[model samples]
Target chain A: MTDPDTDRHNAKMAKKKAARDKIMATKTDEKGLVIVHTGKGKGKSSSAFGMIFRCIAHDMPCAVVQFIKGGMGTGERDLIIKNFSDLCDFHTMGEGFTWETQDKSRDIEMAQAAWAKAKELIADPVNRMVLLDEINIAIRYDYVDVAEVVTFLRDHKPPMTHVVLTGRNAREELIELADLVTEMELVKHPFRSGVKAQAGVEF
Target chain B: MTDPDTDRHNAKMAKKKAARDKIMATKTDEKGLVIVHTGKGKGKSSSAFGMIFRCIAHDMPCAVVQFIKGGMGTGERDLIIKNFSDLCDFHTMGEGFTWETQDKSRDIEMAQAAWAKAKELIADPVNRMVLLDEINIAIRYDYVDVAEVVTFLRDHKPPMTHVVLTGRNAREELIELADLVTEMELVKHPFRSGVKAQAGVEF
Candidate 1:
């Protein structure tokens, strides 16, 4: 008893759904993923943290290693520390941005320490997702060897663990190795107009 | 006495923090923000959801009206429905993608209903953050009038409320009006390689 438009819509949706099912049928592979988020826009790390939140919702274990952003307080870190501490291994190991530190050797040392922790988390099969927050920045600065990182991921990573690397200037090697890579392009930012970062939105 | 490297790092950071503090001092205005997330890459809606999580952490009330993504089960929707129902007003008011539905009149009706709900949320001062999820797509398809949407936002949005719009092909008008805009460019995606969208990652 449906009208012509409703009948037509239903028929069209049925056809589309069938085609989608056929496409879905071919995607049978299940394994870990290497996800990379990079570029000058704001959401690279925020989006990674979003995934961590999603993992938390599903009760999946997660580990986070922040390479160059630990010198100051961030809302996401504080929230994780306060509520989801049991499900998350959160480490903010950096002394701050490289420019702020202004010490190449010290920055390299911190990056190495963070990488050590990242390797440990990746090697452990218990953790479902390991977020290498800002690790790309470290790699971009040559604090961590890109080839070594790739080799470790290929040789040592668990089969079902997801690893997310985020920051600006991600290496070509990492991008090539990643299963998903997103570049957050800066279209417009309030900061350029003298608006400062605010809580509950920026951090 | 600390090591020379440590001392130098501390001095540099002190100077940098001071400069940052100076910049922070000038930022006195606080008001609502119109934020837009657009482009071909993923994480536009995911990043907006991340902010919703942040708001939940801060005990802020939020309202989300999804324009074109409610034909099936999504992990994020389920998670919020299960846990954070008290803090968020969640609405999924679309039949599916435009191609799937293939009915302009029905799509317009759904878009109008969603926009009505969006206006209600945006006008309510109790809602600190109102996310108009995928409204850009609705506007792109001309199911809703862009001018009307912009006028409503400009005239009715509460001063302290934040409104976020997520979807591809954001209108130039919205971009011009937004305080923060991010274009997520796709660098690589596993879907192109036959990897299906898995739960907890894509949803």
Candidate 2:
């Protein structure tokens, strides 16, 4: 009772399913990965935070250390602090952005302290994921040495810890070392049209 | 006890703060945003979910209509169903990918149905945010008319309901209509190196 179109469609789908199965069979290697989110567009930090929420849903321990945002009251940060303090070790270690701080020596000191906490979190086997939010900006400003950060990640990170480093202008060394890297290219932004950042979205 | 560096830093920060305050004074307009996330990389859907999590934190009602993933048991979907069900209305409308479905008529029917649900959510003032997940793919394939979608979005959507569309190869017309658009460019992918997607990250 099947029509000719239905038969053709079924045949095509079966072939595709078979091909996908073949590809899936070949992908068996399993290990923790270094993921990098960068570029001029948005979602670099938001996506990392999404992964953190996923970890929370799965009951996996995770840590987040903000490098440049300081202690500013972001919706994501506040939510985590209020509901997920037990599951997440969240830290805001900077006074503010570089332009606001306007002190190179102090910026470098703050970056070093944040990096120390990040390193400790990466070494902990109990933590399933670690997000070094905005570390790329610190690296770009030369406040934190990218080579040292890369070396520590390579040598000290636990086998099962997925480390996510996010910010614009990620260093080539870190990108080369990462297993996954996505550059969020800016296509269009409303701020150019005089729209300010708003709550529940921008925060 | 104040050193020259501290005094210099203080003066510079004060000037920067004043400049920021001036800029902040001008940004007062508030409205819903048309957000598009597209290109050949990850985090498009993840970041949208992050926004949804932010909405949940704010006790803002949201809706998600997944167009291409079908009824896959993703961790994000499960978490929303289990814990955030009261806050988020989630729907998976597609049978699968086009290749997996291999039925043009059926795909078109499913896309239309999903669009109807999306429109309902967008028009409702109660929904602060509505995610048309993977709608770009449906538009790219012509399964759903892009012009009608854009027209309805412009004319019928509530003023305060932020509409987020996610998928690869977003239509230029949609981009032109969007207030925010991000192109996620793939820098590197673990799947290329034979690493499979893992739980609590890929899901």
Candidate 3:
């Protein structure tokens, strides 16, 4: 005779599998996504970069337009630009964080220039994925107009091109428009405990 | 004469640099970290893989032990095992998720086997990073003991070997002992919007 425990477990799994299968069956549509990563924590931009790497692994063309983070080079940036230069378009557009720059008008000018570049990338049909790094922070600081950005994202983005916006304080309107949004919440940080960011891990 | 805008920006950056330099000077100690990624959103395991990729790019050795994902082949698992076999010690230990397996004793046995492999990797001083993918889900289902795991992580892991645990429902003690913790909150998800998991994006 079959074991009673095994029989019970199999039955439960079968039921769950049926439910999952039904759900999976109903999802057949495919389209590019408007993805957003935000909140007061680390890894927002890193996660976006992870997606870009995934796209590159699949031989998809990708572009990154960094805003508000231009003071130094990072290991990820260096490696991607060095190795995957043909598959990836890497751009560092910001002068620095607002607190470092300390000039509102100049920040706005830089943000506008970055947005223009972002628009150009978005319009390119060959780009399968485009990452707007720290664009949320630019919108939060009023360096970029949220309304116009939302309008452009909704109306002008290529239909099959995935776009990722990453930074803290993502606008609510942007969140509403995004197909997927993940908020990276800070639970505990080594920085608060006097640990400095390292090269391979935090850069 | 320098442009006023450029001069003001330079002065502000210098002041910020001074503050940053002071903080950087105090952080001289470097040690391995226990990083936890948990919550209701996605990207926990993907972020860990990103770190592994980063380590591989830096020519650092890494290991991964997958506990509760075993039914199907994923792009990441296939690609890493095929391409970076030398640098990555990849292990998929669990038969599948608990619900899918539906065998408590079998699940516990598999978890124990996975832990054995993890211990071996942890003992190896050559590994610079170790990713315990879905170990939290195993512990959550009572397949593994949290206290024992924590004790081992605290006392046995190599000093410079970074360990990453990724899954939902991370235990409070684990969180307390971790150097960095990120909770990925679900703001929005395409799965909820009836989009099925895709190849490059999801896997």
Candidate 4:
């Protein structure tokens, strides 16, 4: 005798499979994406690095242009450069965070320099991916002109290069232009409970 | 004569450095964390794997127990097991997603088995980090007991073992127990725009 529960499960799964297949069938387009990772929580930069790692595993060349975060060395930055030096272009262009530099004009200069590097990377067809790490923060602070950045992103980016922008407080125009955007919301943070950031975990 | 911009920038940076130093001095405590990555967006599992990569780079041992995601092979799973076999303990225990399997009892059985493996990993002091990937979906679907999982995480986890749980619709109790919880909010997704999941980006 067949188990009633198993029978029911099989029927349900068959229906679900059909629905999923239908949806999957509708999805067929393929193109490079303008991706944004933003908001008040963690993992924006981490997720970008994850994609970089994925690209590295696939033997695709990638570049990272870090803005507004150059005071300390990060494990990801170090490991990628050390392991995949030929395939990765790692650039830390900012002197430090705004709160750590306090010079608005200097910050603007650094951001512009970083943007120049980002543009160069984006223009290179050889680079499959370019991560503009913390560029949103620089744009948010007016260190880089948002409108100009948006215009370049819309017009100048290579057709096959995926660009990932990560930071808190991403502007409205960028979000509207992005093919994908994820806003990480802080539900709870250990820092609020007095837990300090660890090297491997935070960096 | 000193360039006005350079001189101004130096003085401003010095003051900013002093303020940052003051804030940095107070952060001293260090402990393992119970981190939850949940909600309606991408990057939950990707971020967890990024942490795993960090741990691997630091020569720390890590383990992954995947629930509700075992039908297909992922690049991360394949690469980590192949390259860092000694450092990573990867177990994909679930048969597939709930909709794919559609068997409540079998799903529950798989979840319980996965939990058993997770407990064993957590109990072993050798594993510095344990990622319970997509366990939240199992718990949300009633395949596993959230209360029991919470109790083990709170009372039984090793002092220095960092645990990262990732999935959508994490229970309130689990969030409450987590040291850090990040909710990945979906601002936009390519699937909505009829774009299929790509190999490097999605898996």
Model 2: how large is the Cα RMSD against the reference?
A: 2.6
TM-score of each: 0.88, 0.91, 0.89, 0.91
After superposing candidate 4, which stretches have Cα over 4 Å from the reference?
Answer: A70-73, B1-23, B70-73
- lDDT tens string, model 2, A87-115? 99999887788767777678889999999
Q: What's the residue-level lDDT of B181 in candidate 3?
A: 96
- Pairs that collide, model 3: none
Instruction: Kindly list the per-residue Cα lDDT of model 4 for residues B71-155, writing each as its tens digit.
Output: 3227577767767879889998998887777677788899999999999999998999999999998899777899999999999
Over 4 Å off, model 3: A1-6, A70-73, A101-106, B1-21, B70-73, B103-105
Q: Taking the candidates in order, what DockQ does each have?
A: 0.44, 0.55, 0.47, 0.53
Estimate, for each residue in B1-203, the C-alpha lDDT of model 2 and write its tens digit: 66897678678867887898788777787889999999999889888887887888889999999997742226677778877889899999988888787777788899999999999888989999999999998899888899998999899988888999999999999999999999999999999889998766787
All models: lDDT? Answer: 0.84, 0.86, 0.82, 0.84
Alpha-carbon DockQ of candidate 4: 0.53
- Tens digits of per-residue lDDT, candidate 3, A1-203, equal 56887788778877887887788898876778999988886667766777777777778899999996752226567768877889899998998887677666788899999999999999998999999999988998777899999999899998888999988889999998999999999999887767776655676
Please identify model 2 stretches exceeding 4 Å from their true place.
A1-11, A70-73, B1-24, B70-73
lDDT of 1 by residue, A120-203 (tens): 999999999999998988898788999999999988999899999998889999888899999999998777777766666875
Model 3 per-residue lDDT tens digits across residues B45-146: 766776777787787888989986752225567657866789989999988877666666788899999989998998899999998888998888667899
Candidate 4 has an lDDT of 0.84
Q: In model 4, what are the clashing residue pairs, if there are any?
A: none
